[model samples]
Target: MKLSKRLQQVAELVPEGAVLADIGSDHAYLPVYLVEQGRIRQAVAGELNQGPYESAQRTVREAGLSHLIEVRKGDGLAVLGAGEASAVAICGMGGGTIVDILSAGRDKLAGVQCLILQPMTDSDRLRKWLHDNGWRIAAEELVVDEGILYEIVQAEPGDERYKDSLWYEIGSVDLLKHHPLFPQKVSAAIKKIGRVLQNLRKSQGGLAAQKREALLQKKKRLEEVLKSCKQR
Candidate 1:
């Protein structure tokens, strides 16, 4: 019933006694661990393909949580009924894909109290999607398992806009500043923006100049955030 650092952070976001639905639940480790820890009362593990579906079933069965955790073969939140899950966890997927899943299953989220998402990339787009769809980023977590950094976004039903468009690209500085990896996260983002700017400098396209200017502004904002944190 052990969970990986990434999944463990997602698990931590689930409120106690919640009925959680885990999307793309490969191996079903998160649900098993949550149930074992008495963190949740029940869970539904959803897998899109047969291989992972069977793997999840086996994991739940082996853990003897068959009575508590149901393994379903389906795509995204299709395995869930409206109001069936109070919390949903989607981990280890690209942000765009996670956003699409949530978009397509909007009906199934009628009563979902929280969404715990771990996006492998496009964190900016994911944040934008949440803001547009009335989900407020309640809390954020940063954890690096092995050498890879992962971000876990815990959101609840609400609507809130960032200070400007840039906050979506880099999450709320106030929320992220508390994490031990805050500096690393900001530096990594700055590095990424720098690489893009360097590529833009070589581009002959009409929009390259405009894009570079915007990214440069973003990078400056990130540095300012880092410096402000240090001054505190």
Candidate 2:
């Protein structure tokens, strides 16, 4: 099974010998790859939709990994209990949905040592949720696969700490520094901010001005961060 660069990057972050549960495991590719590579001892592919759930089961069986990977049809983390998995991977979903899943299953995460998440959108929301819920960003990576940029964040529950201000807008500076696509990511964000500011300037409303100013400030801060990354 050939995995996308983004999925492969997410799989690489899973520590060797860990037990993994992949939430929304569409096709169950990640778990199957990890088990075949001996990177994880065991894995469970959790899916809600019938199509993907059955597809995951078929993939596991085809890969000859049915003994090592379990395909369970369920929503979010409800399929597994605490202590069942050392790490959890939730990918190909929005950040808000990811946060909601984790939030809903907070009790089941007590034994989870690591979380690898790739949000399709609302990444800042996911980061804020992690910080608010006592999860510390251990590492972050950016990968562009077929012209789409994806951010993979590895977090663990703890008081590792992050500023509330930076939590939503920017990811971990350390991880950003090491990102293979850091320049492109920052450049793309700058373009987005610029476009937003331009639109805000054209709109006439009481709230528009305030929103524009706030976005402008954020744009400046992002520029500064990008400059710092360049210096490194």
Candidate whose lDDT is highest: 1
TM-score, each model?
0.96, 0.95
lDDT of 1 by residue, 57-154 (tens): 99999899999999999889999999999999999999999999999999999999999999999999999999999899999999999999899999
Please name the candidate that would achieve the greatest TM-score relative to the true structure: 1
Predictions in order: lDDT: 0.91, 0.88
Model 2 lDDT per residue over 1-232, tens place: 6789999999988888999999999999999989888889999999999999999999999999898999999889999988899999999999989989999998889889999999999998998888878898888988888989889999987886565475465677766766657877877888999998877777998789889888888888888878887877
lDDT value for candidate 1?
Answer: 0.91
The segments of candidate 2 whose C-alpha lies over 4 angstroms from its true place after superposition are none
Q: So what's the TM-score on candidate 2?
A: 0.95
